[model samples]
Target: MARAPKDHKTNALRELDAAGIVHEALFFDADPAMTGVQIAQSQGEDVDAVFKTLVTEGKSGEHYVFLVPVACELDLKKASAAAGEKSVAMVRARDLLPLTGYVHGGCSPIGMKKRFATFVDETAQLFDEIYFSGGKVGCQVRMAPDDLALLVPFAYADLTA
Candidate 1:
């Protein structure tokens, strides 16, 4: 029998279950030293197909979630426009924990304390399947991009360069 994830009740997994989204959770020997790209590469996945959850603070002083490919960078201007804010800036790691109930690398787009407006990178639509943090290091959840869209009330936009 396989062992359960260290943080099994994470907002990410809970949201997926609540939405009835089908996904396969994959756990690997996590290396805290590795980046998301490194982790995906180690798992034999295309880096572009791996999505990273990033939290940004809008000019209005509210935080929003941006789901983009690991290999791409978040376009703050586009994200800001998508969120209907004047500007968007990356939130520091220390500030993220209290806001999302998860640490830096472990943050997931789902199950946030307050649902902020979210944006999914348009590039994500090109992939049939994408991998995202499973609310913890050493684990990831794979699901269809469309399914993820349903789970997150996010605007699909060209928010990545």
Candidate 2:
């Protein structure tokens, strides 16, 4: 039997439920033209506490997912090192849906189409609860960093430049 994901209901939220973690979902306009920082600003959120999910493909053809604060940039060198890859580059935007089941501005580390090695920038450790896309546009999930770890096994690394 196929098992369903846990609480809050969106696939991403379901993921948290299945993982036995608790979190709240925040909905907002998921405008393609809006940067993560812009979305955070519209919600009156501290930009640093809102994170974006990035999809990258390693030199060897494996995909990796990274989460970093909305206002920060991912340092390729640091990401590559963290993933144990010689190099990794962002997957083309058009490829995201077919590859990760997410659109460019709405990717989430929790409910990707397939599990990939995931990393969260070390800065997220600074917050008791942080926000990230909820596997779709217009929604964000807020949860303690420790709870998030239960859904996506990730390491804390210097992913931001």
Candidate 3:
């Protein structure tokens, strides 16, 4: 028998379920040292279809979220523009858990301490489904961009460098 999603419950998964968003939860052996790209490679997932969730603090003191391919760099200028901020900076690692309710490597755009304006790289739309951390290290969630948008209300933008 297959394990149920509740067996691997995480804030991200719970939110998806509550929103009626269909998604697949994938669990893997998590090495603390592995980068997002390495995690994707370990699972035989395409680098471009595995996204990393990032949180940033804008000049106005507002927070925002961005999802980019695991192997790409977020273009800060583009990110600032997309978020309508004069500039944006990554939230300090020490503050991540408190601010987002997730650790650095486990952050997911789906369920945050509070919803911030979220954006996904435009390239994500090219794939049928994209994967991201399922609110914890060693777990991932796969869903269509449209489903994600409906659940989280994100916009697609040129977010990667």
The candidate maximizing lDDT is 3
| Clash count per candidate | 0, 4, 0
Tens-digit lDDT track of model 2 for 124-144: 999999999888777888899
Every candidate's lDDT: 0.84, 0.87, 0.90
Which has the better lDDT: candidate 2, or candidate 3? 3
Candidate 1 lands at a TM-score of: 0.91
Residue pairs with clashing backbones, model 3: none
User: Any idea what lDDT model 1 has?
Assistant: 0.84
Alpha carbon lDDT of residue 41, candidate 2?
Answer: 92
Instruction: Give a tens-digit lDDT track for model 1, residues 41-69.
Output: 98899999898999999888988899998
TM-score of each: 0.91, 0.91, 0.94
| 34-140: candidate 3 lDDT, tens digit per residue | 98888889889999999999999999999999999999999999999999999999999899999999998999998898999999999999999999989987889
Candidate 3 regions off by >4 Å? 1-7
